[model samples]
Target: MGENRIQQNEMSRRSFIVGAAAGTAGLAAAGLFSGCSAQPNTSTDNAEKTNSPTIPEEFTDGVYLTKAISMHGPINVKTVIADGAISEVTVLNNRESYVIGEAAINSMPQRILDSQCIDVDCVTGATLTSMAIQNAVSEAITLAGGDPGNFKGYQSPEPKEADVERECDVAIMGAGMAGLMAAWKLAENGKSVMVFEKMPYVGGCMPITSTAWNAQDTIIQKAWGTEQIFEAWSSVEAQLQSYREGRIEPDNPYYNPDMPFITPMFDAARDATDMMINIGVGFCPISDWPAPQLAPGAFSIGGKFCLDIVKNYLTYQLGVEIITEAPVTELVTNEGAVTGLVAKGADGTVYHIASKAVMLASGGYISNNELMEQYQPDELKFPLMGPPWATGDGLLLGQEAGAALETMDQGVTSHYSGAVSHAEISYIHYVCPGVVVNGSGARFVSENMEYKQALRVFKDQPTTDFYWVFDEVSRQGMVPSGNSYRLDYTFLLETGDATEAGNYQELAEKLNLPDLTATLDAVNECARNGAVDEFGNEKLRAMLLDGNMYAIKVTPTPYIAQGGLKVDPACHVQKEDGTPIAGLYAAGDVVGSVENRDGAMYRIGLTQAIAYGLIAGETMSAEL
Candidate 1:
């Protein structure tokens, strides 16, 4: 970890990079966006790339080093030039998110070498990393006494044609939370399981994850010396009543008026803790909180890392088969039941995988703009917060396999989608005792309220910008319980995304908010008295009198476009007539979950991935 480690080596799950982080961080640390100023050589020199271009004789056979831009920072690369041809391009160091970064770094060099062109498409869902690699190579070319722009437009070598055929007891689409979950259970039950992910990486939207979510009497809980805690599904009855009143189609069969719970969701919610633990996704309980929700370690081992643990356990220990960068293009059906799928691999190999059961967990359609504009307005689309690979392939596959769609427009579960920076800095700082004031510098909603409700409250206001204002004491009190998933507030200050002032008047002038001084006094008055304020908020009980008062701007961005294929309690992809599609199952974001109004985080969204994944895997295991 101290040096630039190769990607093929065993990776450490711990947070912080040491070795490569030291390499080009000086240049990168100068400014957040200044590091990526080196532009691509777009001279269009031989745009057709037919004739082979000769290497400049000035270039000697030697190694060259250069730096390029990555998602978070800079990537140092070593380029090998031998025998008058650019040979190997090795990424010396970077600190990108593991999955997507791996795909681009591991493959792009060989891809360029094969094609022999500086002009090539970056890996899907990995634009920044891909550019970083190519740009590093371009710099190396310049350093080798040659025009870097000359590397483009060479006739590309043709890929060897190949095809692969396989048979498995279960074939799972997507290597995300739900698919990997299903693979774990199926493999454990001695079933031959194969998981295919279209993206070059394993984790789908999970790489952008935060919570460990809703576990009751699991091992982690036991170690915390806490008894089993039941998560109150307060919104279930309301959702059920709404469904009963109008939401359900006449043919929909999942609803039973006498049933106390939304059966599949409830059953899955209860098992989530044990299921995650069993899958080897590790975490700890929220401090002093009695709820079963876990706070997964952020920035390092939080969302995608948790899934990576599950993926590693599934593939290495449980013997689950996962093929990345291979997209299942179509479903092969026989007499109205899906029997298999056809996929194309990254190496131009066709994969015909035949299976007894197919589980569709390819995730939501947030990344697909055409599908997104259908359900949401351009202004409200929190598209960037979504994992770039969630292109709704599974939904399309389900539709092809005769599944009904519902709630496609309602999937933006959180009112504020995700991240101030869509790239590596999406994680917001901890939701602490703070005041989010509008442009006029007045607290609009209760600081402790959920984002879904917060956005609703703010919509009536006339301002576009919102600032999270808090004192030094309040920030320090909350830092120990920080989630790196939120953008670092300190980093925000360094990057000028936030402003800090020693006092209220200074802070007000810096942000051009004239009313901030009055706002703080009223808040301090309420805090000193230890009573509810006008907004009925007790969360603002912290006085803003500490050193270095801070204000970080926050925006409600686009995230997961929720609502998708409707499924029964059994995890079956339901048809319009409320009938099950034989040999087909769906889980995760592709299927809608039990509705909730508390602005629940992982409760409804992630629960579907866990619960339905478990149910579908178990059901398929029992059948086969």
Candidate 2:
């Protein structure tokens, strides 16, 4: 139940597992014990009498391994017991997202050891990983001949308060990708920087990000043989067209025609990519979807890799300070210029850090229901896919310091067909060659329309209820391709959100679409004759005429708010009069209008965060 005991147990468990597996047959022949079984023996009854097994005091001592399935994949844990006491727990393997899983992986094992039980509290914002870890530990305890239900963990002593004040050149709220990158840039230039993150872990939403950065002509794109496809002028024109056609909100109050931020940001993105590469970030070719013309020169990498590089370089190489589990509650402003902020540590200790400048990269308010209702009432009804920590803390802090917000009515709403979960949707795969219908069972729009257009169409549906109808062939094609991170078909089917029928009539009946039969017949006739549907989608018209059909319930989930505190090109929070708020800068989802580039044509958010973070860092370093 101590740190030393846990460490010893971990080492013992590894050795025991290796030895046991090596001599499995010999041990069985000698009748020393039964074959290795990961399942726990729950025959013992206790006061709680829960389904979980109760650890008996006279149980044997040994090492045990068990596997538990999590949201992403299986997690394997090894538990060691010594003299009938739970000694240690070790996570052998896990495939959970780094953003949500890393903290749990690092802390849960220790907590289990300290408590001498498997019922420790889970890491917040990481429910799946926490549950999986706890489950694996429970099995391991049972296998180690201990009753998990009866074992009482140690009671942790209350934390003592410490003087945690610090003075720095810059104080950043949030240790996300943007904040970390900015801290690195500033600290590298000989400035003292402190970054505070509310979460016990860093990375924010970066781990869930697409990890695709956009630029004009870049070295990677040139090497990939797709440089000629990305023309700067044409890309801008396409964005303008999207705005002009009202595909994006044309009534954006933050739209500044004279100061087109996209042009400058795109130009700097090339340098950002180069910087990333110099720092050892790797990339794969971007997926050629929505036409390569519209897709900027983009490449994919795991956001965790980028975050790890920035965190290590800033903390070890540049000496930037990062404190996690410290939430900044208020901005301490003096005169007309912003000065510093106050943050609270996990143990309720306050730290008032003074600084010459502050950057609000604490992400958007997608998860804040109050702010969502205040800014975007319509979108508040939908499920949110953004990080849980994006509770508008930065916006509130910036606004309290007299910064102006813009385009508050807009957000990034994605249309995907399935039950809501943490898994990333396969938009490109699901949107191809399918028939979308409303609650009334009537086809609403062309399935092959641009993603934004499809979202708009789905948003306008009655009750916002829709489904994607596809045949077996289409479903087979929907399987994630090589190295694609989208959810696989098997997983989707297992969620029970997708339904299948032998024929169109059965499918329609199952979906309660009274007119689905006739609709399918008409669609089939068009596909048979190679004709375009009413929505002018020839690609969709060529499919939906064959084999077993299916319908996936579709919903538009809010990913990130496209509007936040308005900022200038230098990433300075600006007032309505177009004047910058002195000493206060914003980046990432906290500063909006960047996502509305070319009228919200749907560019990569991660790229904008990195590019603008670098800009903010450089600007603050020079100006402050």
Candidate 3:
């Protein structure tokens, strides 16, 4: 989802510029004028001559300023054009982090200047920043009366053939945390393992964010004195009830009949954590409510940390072979048994990996529009924010090999809790202590419902546009933890996504919510008197009054697919008749029913991936 988000952010920025230009045209027709027109000159004089191109006469000398949105926020650039050439390129302002965005900021502009073109290679690890600079420069060139498209500075790397190929005992698809862990385990057991990754680097979603996992009675949980929390919170009935909460229909076939299998899988998660720690993975403990047993029982390490340790151990210690930019195209099967698979390299070279066993840890199909429409057609209306490579490759391969899928309708949906304008950063405040209203300024779901449940209710809203209204006191208490605090409140305000007003009336006027003032009054009254509102939000009743108030509009975003190929508790791919597919195994997001126990509930994604990966690795190794 991290890589997908970065790409989406870039695409959105480009789209915004295009949309702005179209809007400017409409405004022009309406006799509206601005300081600068968005319409670009389409005259031949601004076009670049391919045979012998030179800087346009109009851009002979001047400084052009343009802004492009980076992964963090807007990046403003100053392009100095002098004597028919780019004399200097300077980044005037950006909110990018020094460690991630600095390299591109420092090196990309110089590359553009040296090459005398706007197109240049992006920094290896700083793709967003690099693209942002390129975009800013391109906008500057357009403003300078030059052909922005003709400034070809960034060049893609030449694709290379698969020069080496060999047989292995097991071939794993993907190099994500789950796939890497599976490779490490199998390789350590003296099995020759090969991993094929479609991406250039390891850690598909890892190295991009931090996530929590669920495990019971782990060393960390014991140390934190919360080892028994899971047993208390997670009973079989509770687990079943969790899955039944937010279904579109009561009779929907989303629930898994073999729901009890989750008990042992979570029980085995402690061993998975121990193995990860033994392999040098470090973790910090964090807490979440209601699911206390599931929350602090495991370690809270950033994806990058887990990826680094597992990748290093797999490559250097276990001697596992990993091929990046190699995507598995088909799974070879003989007499109903998996045998080998065909993969294509970046340069279109095909390599066949013959293996005794195959594991599919290739991730979910959230990024595949066709698959999303096929499985959960309703979800097609919502925006997806998962990795692009999660195109259901493993699921496709499994289906071709006679494996049945389960819980195809389930996926993770995240809420934009703060302000509609602050959608990008609203993910931070998952549980906003305030009243949530639809586009008509009327409350819908209870503000105190769990995040996932809230998402379900929000999705059903008439306009699908909502806001979180809170007082300054409640806002002060909204200090975020987890993978949510990338942007601060001030930044959100700067983006003009958040609305602040001295009183509810003013805020209502700004938000176009005619009934907002009355709604706010009622909510504030409930908060001041500790009275439960009609929504049964007793917890928020005491937290909403006093001081200035704010509103943040939010939209729904589906993060990861919760359904895929059906696998047994041992992580072996299973057919419809309740039999395992010989030599075929799957883990991670590729195995769908792992989370939606009864077809409704969701567990932590990383935990399910890791635990099942461990189980798959051990089971396959035992077969050897």
Candidate 4:
């Protein structure tokens, strides 16, 4: 952790501008890093795009440049084969996710070099990058006219176990937005903190960010007017109504009349913002936050990079120790009160960490398919976003320690994706508000409905498979730019995720949507006339063109889990009887809102975790 603290922070994706002409990866193509001539990455589809190129029967000793698609895009590796053996491997180009994929990028080359083996065990939690490197190596071998099978079966070194025993005033699980903020506060309050993260990286699920949070009286809000706070509360008033009517969870906000549940969250969000700003972090007012934004207000921490400011402060200035790839397995309690925890390091070593108190900030259950099937069955069909480690570790740990659950039935969905399966390169239709048709070939909801509302409409349909019908002119560009949200036609076309036809009717036939021809014609008519049609969508002005049309398969994916460990206002893990478990606490997506257990939901950026995390830290600091 000490050795990697600087490296991982330096390579965080939010502000991943590692300068130098010596830069590898995509920088070489742009001549920004390796000073090579810029070779534009094209979108030419190859019919025989197998996992690896054809393996040659004969040996040819030479450096082979080969590319394999990674989590985000292609990974180009420069392979040196000397005397029919792989001598060296260097990553040439890739926009692979940082933080999560940083370890695989930094270590795989050396590991391959050490063993002359292309099939190494993937770095845990970075399977996509690891797989890409292995495939790229295989392709390189094939290009060098060498049989890729010769490079198989890497014999890794024997595992060794070293159990570590450590003590801290407060031990936090998961070094994400919540855990980090809690650690920062605890350290500031003069507590020694130890943070254990399961992933090789520190950033949580939305490593890029969790979208903008609406704070009431932050400096940005001061500049943008704080009246939006009233609007935000008013927006949730309906949810409050559902709670009162016993339609949702039984968490009545009016239970404590003296302490109306909304204000503390707003104040905490504002203070959390100020906390970051005080540490040299900045903010930007997001006028165009995605739909269903906190009414009248939205903002983020100067983009995703601002989080590193707090991460660095906790690990360096505050001396909080963060052990990455150490998954906390169980809570070590004594006499019915929480005491500490037991964990396992990535190396198979045991970590018995003793602390005065524990905070479970180990993120959500989105990556856990079983939990999804149990809690949110309808969302089970959708693809999951974020790393595979978001399996509700905190929730499991809390349950083992006798904690109750809450909001197990609610969760939010991501943008309606046409082609997010390939390295998260999105389809332009989601943004363009293009012609969307369900499996039945009929337009369902308005294309421009609020993000989640539209997702529900599509997700509830008989089939999860949907399509985005667009013309050749609508085929957008590449995923070369680090922003994954931007459309990448090259990826879609090459992967055949987007199929083309001479016209709309042909495209419909190819996609097997029987009624798409009529749907497409009606949509075209509405767009050409700029008329609000059946769905009342005024934004459908971009009519579908006739020549060489494309239809990309589309569907909504699971964004994050809703249900988690139940906790009270003070961030304490609560029992079914509403009694707080001493020395036990939780924050982040591991628990929904601390104000109530009304629902598992889509909370805006940072504030959800930061608010409860700070409260947990301060409360623990005071109680202990």
Quick one: best lDDT, which candidate? 2
Q: Worst 10-residue stretch by lDDT in candidate 1?
A: 6-15
Q: What's the residue-level lDDT of 606 in candidate 2? A: 69
Each model's lDDT: 0.64, 0.67, 0.66, 0.66
TM-score between model 3 and native: 0.78
TM-score of every prediction relative to native = 0.74, 0.78, 0.78, 0.80
Please give the TM-score that candidate 1 achieves against the real structure. 0.74
Best-performing candidate as measured by TM-score: 4
Question: Residue 7 in model 2: shift from native, Å?
Answer: 39
Query: Model 4, residue 460: displacement in angstroms?
Result: 2.7
Off by over 4 Å in 4: 1-57, 208-211, 221-263, 282-304, 383-386, 411-422, 425-430, 450-455, 472-489, 527-531, 593-606
Per-residue lDDT of candidate 2, residues 1-624 (tens digit): 223432453344334333323222111113322443455556554322433333335566666666664544456777676777778778888656665777788888888888776667778777557766777666555555557677656465676776577899999998876787788778878999999999887877667655665664455555565544533323435444444455344455445454366656665666677676677776655445322211112212266666777788788888998988889998988888889999988886889999999999999887676776667666544455556688899998898899998767655555453542324444634433567788878987877664533555566655666767777767765554522344344444544457888877789888899878788788878888888888887764444444588877766666676688988778888888989888899998888648574355455666677778888888998987
lDDT by residue for model 4 (70-165), tens? 555556777787886878889877666545666788899988888888887788877767777777777666555667788889876775788888
Model 2: lowest-lDDT 10 consecutive positions: 291-300
- For candidate 4, list the clashing residue pairs, or say none: 21-33, 25-92, 25-93
> Once superposed on the true structure, which residue ranges of model 3 sit more than 4 Å away at CA?
1-13, 17-67, 75-130, 140-147, 153-164, 207-209, 227-258, 285-301, 347-349, 415-423, 430-432, 474-489, 541-547, 598-600
Q: What's the number of clashes in each of the models?
A: 14, 3, 20, 3
lDDT of 1 at 426: 32
Candidate 2: which stretches are off by over 4 Å? 1-95, 135-157, 225-259, 286-301, 347-349, 415-417, 420-423, 426-433, 449-455, 477-489, 541-546, 597-602
- For candidate 1, give the lDDT of residue 377: 48
